[model samples]
Target: MSDTAIRVTGRCRCEKNPVRFEYTKVPAEVHYCLCTDCTDISGGAMALIAVVERSTFRITQGESKIHNYDTKPTCHRRFCSECGCHMFLYVDAFPEHLLIHVPTLDRGQDIGAKPDRYVFVNSKLAWLTLPDDGLPRHQGWANSGAPVEV
Candidate 1:
Protein backbone atom coordinates (compact mmCIF):
# COMPACT_ATOMS: atom_id res chain seq x y z
CA MET A 1 0.00 0.00 0.00
CA SER A 2 1.16 3.54 -0.66
CA ASP A 3 2.63 5.24 2.40
CA THR A 4 0.70 8.40 1.54
CA ALA A 5 -1.90 9.14 4.17
CA ILE A 6 -5.51 8.94 3.00
CA ARG A 7 -8.14 11.53 3.63
CA VAL A 8 -11.71 10.35 4.23
CA THR A 9 -14.80 12.48 4.47
CA GLY A 10 -18.36 11.59 5.28
CA ARG A 11 -21.66 13.01 6.40
CA CYS A 12 -24.74 11.96 8.26
CA ARG A 13 -27.37 10.57 5.90
CA CYS A 14 -28.69 14.09 5.93
CA GLU A 15 -26.75 16.07 3.34
CA LYS A 16 -26.93 19.14 5.58
CA ASN A 17 -24.20 17.86 7.88
CA PRO A 18 -20.65 16.71 7.12
CA VAL A 19 -17.72 15.10 8.95
CA ARG A 20 -14.11 15.17 7.84
CA PHE A 21 -11.19 13.05 9.01
CA GLU A 22 -7.71 12.19 7.85
CA TYR A 23 -5.38 9.44 8.92
CA THR A 24 -2.04 10.92 9.90
CA LYS A 25 -0.71 7.40 9.71
CA VAL A 26 -1.99 4.18 8.24
CA PRO A 27 -4.32 2.23 10.50
CA ALA A 28 -2.78 -0.42 12.72
CA GLU A 29 -5.41 -2.84 11.47
CA VAL A 30 -8.42 -3.11 9.19
CA HIS A 31 -10.93 -5.89 8.98
CA TYR A 32 -14.44 -7.08 8.25
CA CYS A 33 -16.68 -8.32 11.05
CA LEU A 34 -19.57 -10.71 10.63
CA CYS A 35 -20.79 -10.65 14.20
CA THR A 36 -24.52 -10.74 14.80
CA ASP A 37 -24.48 -7.50 16.75
CA CYS A 38 -22.80 -5.69 13.87
CA THR A 39 -25.23 -7.13 11.35
CA ASP A 40 -28.24 -6.38 13.51
CA ILE A 41 -27.17 -2.80 14.16
CA SER A 42 -25.97 -1.98 10.64
CA GLY A 43 -28.38 -4.23 8.83
CA GLY A 44 -25.46 -5.58 6.81
CA ALA A 45 -23.76 -8.95 6.55
CA MET A 46 -20.48 -7.45 7.76
CA ALA A 47 -18.89 -4.19 8.83
CA LEU A 48 -15.53 -2.85 7.69
CA ILE A 49 -13.62 -0.98 10.40
CA ALA A 50 -10.36 0.89 10.28
CA VAL A 51 -8.51 1.15 13.58
CA VAL A 52 -7.16 4.66 13.90
CA GLU A 53 -5.87 6.99 16.58
CA ARG A 54 -8.61 8.98 18.28
CA SER A 55 -6.62 12.16 17.85
CA THR A 56 -6.52 11.67 14.09
CA PHE A 57 -10.31 11.89 13.87
CA ARG A 58 -12.48 14.92 14.54
CA ILE A 59 -15.99 16.19 14.08
CA THR A 60 -15.55 19.18 11.85
CA GLN A 61 -19.28 19.77 11.94
CA GLY A 62 -22.53 18.78 13.61
CA GLU A 63 -21.13 17.29 16.79
CA SER A 64 -24.46 17.67 18.50
CA LYS A 65 -26.09 15.11 16.23
CA ILE A 66 -23.62 12.36 17.04
CA HIS A 67 -25.23 9.71 19.21
CA ASN A 68 -23.77 6.78 21.06
CA TYR A 69 -25.14 3.42 22.14
CA ASP A 70 -23.48 1.22 24.70
CA THR A 71 -24.66 -2.10 23.41
CA LYS A 72 -22.40 -4.00 25.75
CA PRO A 73 -20.16 -3.27 28.70
CA THR A 74 -17.15 -2.84 26.41
CA CYS A 75 -18.72 -2.05 23.08
CA HIS A 76 -19.92 1.47 22.35
CA ARG A 77 -21.33 2.36 18.93
CA ARG A 78 -21.75 5.85 17.53
CA PHE A 79 -24.13 7.05 14.88
CA CYS A 80 -25.74 10.13 13.42
CA SER A 81 -29.01 10.56 15.29
CA GLU A 82 -30.50 12.80 12.64
CA CYS A 83 -30.55 10.11 9.96
CA GLY A 84 -29.80 7.02 12.07
CA CYS A 85 -26.57 6.17 10.30
CA HIS A 86 -24.16 4.00 12.27
CA MET A 87 -20.75 5.61 11.74
CA PHE A 88 -18.08 4.54 14.19
CA LEU A 89 -17.42 2.53 17.31
CA TYR A 90 -15.42 2.84 20.53
CA VAL A 91 -14.39 -0.12 22.59
CA ASP A 92 -13.20 -0.19 26.18
CA ALA A 93 -10.03 -1.94 25.08
CA PHE A 94 -8.98 0.95 22.87
CA PRO A 95 -10.07 4.01 24.76
CA GLU A 96 -7.62 6.22 22.85
CA HIS A 97 -8.77 5.30 19.37
CA LEU A 98 -11.85 5.13 17.21
CA LEU A 99 -12.93 2.49 14.70
CA ILE A 100 -14.40 4.04 11.58
CA HIS A 101 -16.77 2.16 9.36
CA VAL A 102 -15.27 2.10 5.87
CA PRO A 103 -18.62 2.34 4.13
CA THR A 104 -19.49 5.48 6.03
CA LEU A 105 -16.54 7.29 4.55
CA ASP A 106 -16.64 9.15 1.25
CA ARG A 107 -17.12 7.10 -1.88
CA GLY A 108 -14.30 6.33 -4.39
CA GLN A 109 -11.84 5.87 -1.55
CA ASP A 110 -9.76 2.68 -1.79
CA ILE A 111 -11.05 0.78 1.25
CA GLY A 112 -11.58 -2.41 -0.76
CA ALA A 113 -8.41 -3.87 0.83
CA LYS A 114 -9.99 -7.13 1.89
CA PRO A 115 -10.10 -7.86 5.58
CA ASP A 116 -7.11 -9.72 6.99
CA ARG A 117 -9.47 -11.93 8.95
CA TYR A 118 -13.05 -12.74 9.77
CA VAL A 119 -14.35 -12.26 13.30
CA PHE A 120 -17.36 -13.86 14.96
CA VAL A 121 -17.76 -16.41 12.20
CA ASN A 122 -19.36 -18.82 14.64
CA SER A 123 -22.36 -16.59 14.86
CA LYS A 124 -22.35 -15.82 11.13
CA LEU A 125 -25.63 -16.55 9.42
CA ALA A 126 -25.81 -19.84 7.56
CA TRP A 127 -27.05 -18.15 4.41
CA LEU A 128 -23.98 -15.95 4.10
CA THR A 129 -20.92 -17.08 2.15
CA LEU A 130 -17.47 -15.80 2.92
CA PRO A 131 -14.89 -16.18 0.18
CA ASP A 132 -12.64 -19.22 0.16
CA ASP A 133 -9.52 -17.08 0.38
CA GLY A 134 -7.44 -18.20 3.34
CA LEU A 135 -7.85 -15.29 5.69
CA PRO A 136 -7.60 -16.11 9.37
CA ARG A 137 -11.03 -16.71 10.80
CA HIS A 138 -11.83 -16.35 14.49
CA GLN A 139 -14.76 -17.17 16.72
CA GLY A 140 -14.54 -13.81 18.45
CA TRP A 141 -11.82 -11.31 19.22
CA ALA A 142 -8.33 -12.45 18.24
CA ASN A 143 -6.54 -12.75 21.58
CA SER A 144 -3.24 -13.64 19.95
CA GLY A 145 -2.83 -10.11 18.64
CA ALA A 146 -1.17 -7.46 20.77
CA PRO A 147 -3.46 -5.53 23.08
CA VAL A 148 -4.43 -2.05 21.90
CA GLU A 149 -2.74 0.51 24.14
CA VAL A 150 -3.64 4.10 24.81
Candidate 2:
Protein backbone atom coordinates (compact mmCIF):
# COMPACT_ATOMS: atom_id res chain seq x y z
CA MET A 1 0.00 0.00 0.00
CA SER A 2 1.12 3.56 -0.69
CA ASP A 3 2.47 5.31 2.35
CA THR A 4 0.10 8.20 1.72
CA ALA A 5 -2.72 5.84 2.64
CA ILE A 6 -1.55 5.71 6.24
CA ARG A 7 -1.78 8.38 8.95
CA VAL A 8 -0.09 8.80 12.30
CA THR A 9 -0.63 11.21 15.19
CA GLY A 10 1.59 12.57 17.93
CA ARG A 11 1.72 15.09 20.78
CA CYS A 12 4.24 16.88 22.92
CA ARG A 13 4.83 16.34 26.65
CA CYS A 14 2.71 19.18 27.98
CA GLU A 15 -0.33 17.95 29.91
CA LYS A 16 -2.40 21.11 29.53
CA ASN A 17 -1.13 22.64 26.32
CA PRO A 18 0.31 19.82 24.35
CA VAL A 19 1.51 20.47 20.82
CA ARG A 20 -0.26 17.98 18.62
CA PHE A 21 0.63 16.97 15.10
CA GLU A 22 -0.21 14.43 12.42
CA TYR A 23 1.18 13.24 9.14
CA THR A 24 -0.87 11.51 6.46
CA LYS A 25 1.93 10.17 4.29
CA VAL A 26 4.63 7.66 5.00
CA PRO A 27 8.03 9.18 5.59
CA ALA A 28 10.52 9.33 2.76
CA GLU A 29 13.17 8.00 5.11
CA VAL A 30 13.59 6.93 8.68
CA HIS A 31 16.88 6.31 10.46
CA TYR A 32 18.94 6.54 13.58
CA CYS A 33 20.96 9.80 13.92
CA LEU A 34 24.07 9.83 16.04
CA CYS A 35 25.15 13.38 15.31
CA THR A 36 26.33 15.25 18.36
CA ASP A 37 23.80 18.05 17.89
CA CYS A 38 20.87 15.62 17.88
CA THR A 39 22.20 13.43 20.67
CA ASP A 40 23.16 16.36 22.88
CA ILE A 41 19.91 18.23 22.60
CA SER A 42 17.81 15.09 23.08
CA GLY A 43 20.02 13.82 25.90
CA GLY A 44 20.21 10.43 24.25
CA ALA A 45 22.97 8.45 22.62
CA MET A 46 21.09 8.56 19.32
CA ALA A 47 17.91 9.90 17.75
CA LEU A 48 15.27 8.16 15.69
CA ILE A 49 14.07 10.48 12.94
CA ALA A 50 11.27 10.17 10.42
CA VAL A 51 11.76 12.35 7.38
CA VAL A 52 8.21 13.39 6.44
CA GLU A 53 7.43 15.60 3.52
CA ARG A 54 6.48 19.10 4.68
CA SER A 55 3.35 19.10 2.54
CA THR A 56 1.99 16.00 4.30
CA PHE A 57 2.71 17.06 7.87
CA ARG A 58 0.87 19.62 10.00
CA ILE A 59 0.48 20.91 13.49
CA THR A 60 -3.03 20.06 14.65
CA GLN A 61 -3.12 21.78 18.01
CA GLY A 62 -1.30 24.10 20.41
CA GLU A 63 0.31 26.09 17.68
CA SER A 64 0.74 28.98 20.07
CA LYS A 65 2.79 26.77 22.35
CA ILE A 66 5.31 25.81 19.75
CA HIS A 67 8.81 27.27 19.80
CA ASN A 68 11.75 27.18 17.44
CA TYR A 69 15.35 26.78 18.44
CA ASP A 70 18.00 27.11 15.80
CA THR A 71 20.44 24.39 16.75
CA LYS A 72 22.49 25.46 13.76
CA PRO A 73 22.19 27.99 10.98
CA THR A 74 20.79 25.26 8.78
CA CYS A 75 18.64 23.54 11.37
CA HIS A 76 15.54 24.85 13.11
CA ARG A 77 14.26 22.54 15.81
CA ARG A 78 10.67 22.91 16.91
CA PHE A 79 9.43 22.05 20.36
CA CYS A 80 6.59 22.57 22.76
CA SER A 81 7.22 25.74 24.74
CA GLU A 82 5.14 24.58 27.65
CA CYS A 83 6.83 21.25 28.23
CA GLY A 84 10.00 21.79 26.24
CA CYS A 85 9.80 18.65 24.17
CA HIS A 86 11.53 18.75 20.81
CA MET A 87 9.24 16.92 18.42
CA PHE A 88 10.21 18.01 14.95
CA LEU A 89 12.70 20.04 12.97
CA TYR A 90 13.52 21.57 9.62
CA VAL A 91 16.87 21.36 7.90
CA ASP A 92 17.93 23.77 5.20
CA ALA A 93 19.54 20.91 3.29
CA PHE A 94 16.17 19.10 3.14
CA PRO A 95 13.81 21.97 2.52
CA GLU A 96 10.97 19.70 1.44
CA HIS A 97 10.92 17.64 4.60
CA LEU A 98 10.36 17.87 8.32
CA LEU A 99 12.33 15.58 10.60
CA ILE A 100 10.06 14.22 13.30
CA HIS A 101 11.33 12.59 16.42
CA VAL A 102 9.93 9.05 16.37
CA PRO A 103 9.16 8.84 20.08
CA THR A 104 6.66 11.68 19.82
CA LEU A 105 4.15 9.43 18.10
CA ASP A 106 1.20 8.27 20.15
CA ARG A 107 1.84 4.90 21.73
CA GLY A 108 1.29 1.94 19.43
CA GLN A 109 0.67 3.99 16.29
CA ASP A 110 2.27 2.45 13.25
CA ILE A 111 5.14 4.80 12.38
CA GLY A 112 4.44 3.95 8.73
CA ALA A 113 8.11 3.30 8.08
CA LYS A 114 11.03 1.42 9.55
CA PRO A 115 14.49 2.87 10.10
CA ASP A 116 16.67 1.84 7.14
CA ARG A 117 20.07 2.83 8.47
CA TYR A 118 22.13 4.62 11.11
CA VAL A 119 23.79 7.93 10.24
CA PHE A 120 26.66 9.89 11.78
CA VAL A 121 28.04 6.75 13.39
CA ASN A 122 31.43 8.42 13.51
CA SER A 123 30.00 10.75 16.14
CA LYS A 124 28.32 8.00 18.14
CA LEU A 125 29.14 7.96 21.83
CA ALA A 126 31.89 5.61 22.88
CA TRP A 127 29.91 3.98 25.70
CA LEU A 128 27.02 2.99 23.47
CA THR A 129 26.99 -0.08 21.26
CA LEU A 130 25.24 -0.49 17.95
CA PRO A 131 22.61 -3.23 17.82
CA ASP A 132 22.89 -6.34 15.67
CA ASP A 133 19.92 -5.36 13.54
CA GLY A 134 22.02 -5.30 10.33
CA LEU A 135 21.03 -1.81 9.24
CA PRO A 136 23.63 0.05 7.23
CA ARG A 137 25.77 2.48 9.17
CA HIS A 138 26.85 5.71 7.59
CA GLN A 139 29.63 8.05 8.66
CA GLY A 140 27.48 11.06 7.76
CA TRP A 141 24.21 11.94 6.09
CA ALA A 142 22.73 8.92 4.35
CA ASN A 143 22.24 10.61 0.99
CA SER A 144 25.68 12.19 0.63
CA GLY A 145 27.82 9.53 2.24
CA ALA A 146 28.72 5.88 1.87
CA PRO A 147 27.98 3.23 4.47
CA VAL A 148 30.70 2.60 7.05
CA GLU A 149 31.85 -0.81 8.20
CA VAL A 150 30.01 -1.67 11.37
Q: Which one is best on lDDT?
A: 2
Worst 10 residues of 1 by lDDT: 141-150
Task: Give me candidate 2's TM-score against the actual structure.
Answer: 0.96
| Candidate 1 lDDT tens digits, 13-128 | 77776444445546667777778878888888888788777876777777888889988889999888888888888988888888888788778766534467776677778888
Q: Measured by C-alpha RMSD in angstroms, how accurate is candidate 1?
A: 5.0
List candidate 1 segments past 4 Å from native. Answer: 1-4, 111-114, 144-150
RMSD of each: 5.0, 1.3
**After superposition, candidate 2 runs with Cα above 4 Å error:** 1-3
Q: Pick by TM-score: which candidate is best?
A: 2
lDDT of 2 at 1: 62
lDDT of 2 at 43: 98
Candidate 2: deviation at residue 20, Å?
Answer: 0.5
